[model samples]
Target: MNFELFIARGILSKDKNNFSRPIVRISIISISLGLAVMILSLAITTGFKDAISQKVIGFGSHIKITSFDLNKSFESSPVDMQQPFYPSLADSTGIRHIQVFATKSGLVKSEDQIQGIVMKGIWSDFDRSFFAKNIVEGDLITIDPEKRTNDILISKRIADKLEFNL
Candidate 1:
């Protein structure tokens, strides 16, 4: 059918003027509003999810290293005890920051509430200051290495669940 003939047979028809009234305008507005809301909601939700993921992935090193022997744990420990001195390990492999860390499983006891958490010991380089922007609590690593600052930086989720003040 030709374009003008098709439209004339429908809305422009003498018997069909009622079909092209306010109802059609309302339906068009409703569909446009629905689409606008859906697109806006999706954009906000995806943006928030991406921002959260970036913060988490940025807080750690790109890669890690372990030993060929003594498969005890992924806990942070002295590099000497953790790995055999391999000469080739000195190569940066394009990573910006390379540090050794150890993890120790422990239960955080705050009054009657107890939370099972892995205490990660890392060099001062990997301390909270490295993730200061994402950190929502107390001051970043200000303590000296000689004094192992038992100061642990917990995630926002954990802090809220445990009712931790900051």
Candidate 2:
């Protein structure tokens, strides 16, 4: 056998009552536990990342196309929906869908309380699955392409703070 292997075998042999046996065993166990903790940490971190990403993406899509204006406000500049690339984006290799959205910064008033909020406007083509899954109390808003609805959906935290309900 090789010199290293021979020496290691001698050191690790069961019949030997050498001091190195306990040291080697402790070192092996510590290394194993450290590796296990690292693996578990990595797994937990990956799971958290995926979950948080899904939640964020649920609120909005992965990629957004907006006007290149230098406005530093919550309101985004308008992009034309009739662009030639809009229709063909779905057929592209990686893109699954595309939708238009608009946001406006406004204030909500109830009794004497007023809270500033950003309102997101969505149309019939917008995805409602995320809101549907996360709606804690009220039902999803029905969007009609022909007629406009005054219904609005707000988060539970905002509802509690503003003392509002469905």
Query: How many clashes does each candidate structure show, in the order listed?
Result: 5, 0
Could you give me the TM-score of model 2 versus the true structure?
Answer: 0.85
Best by lDDT: 2
lDDT of 2: 0.88
lDDT of each: 0.68, 0.88
Query: RMSDs, each prediction?
Result: 5.1, 2.3
Backbone clashes in candidate 2 total: 0
* Predicted structure with the largest TM-score when compared to the true one: 2
For candidate 2, write residues 20-109 as lDDT tens digits. 898998998999999999999999999999999999988878898889888988899888888988778888998766788999999988
Error of 1 at 89 (Å): 9.5
Residue runs of model 1 more than 4 Å from their true location after superposition: 1-16, 59-94, 127-130, 156-166
Q: In candidate 1, what are the lDDT values of residues 1-166, reduced to their tens digit?
A: 9997796467545666576766766886899999999999999999999987776667655555654656576454445744554444556475455565777888877766888887767775563545776666776766577786657778777777678895
lDDT of model 1 at position 42 = 100
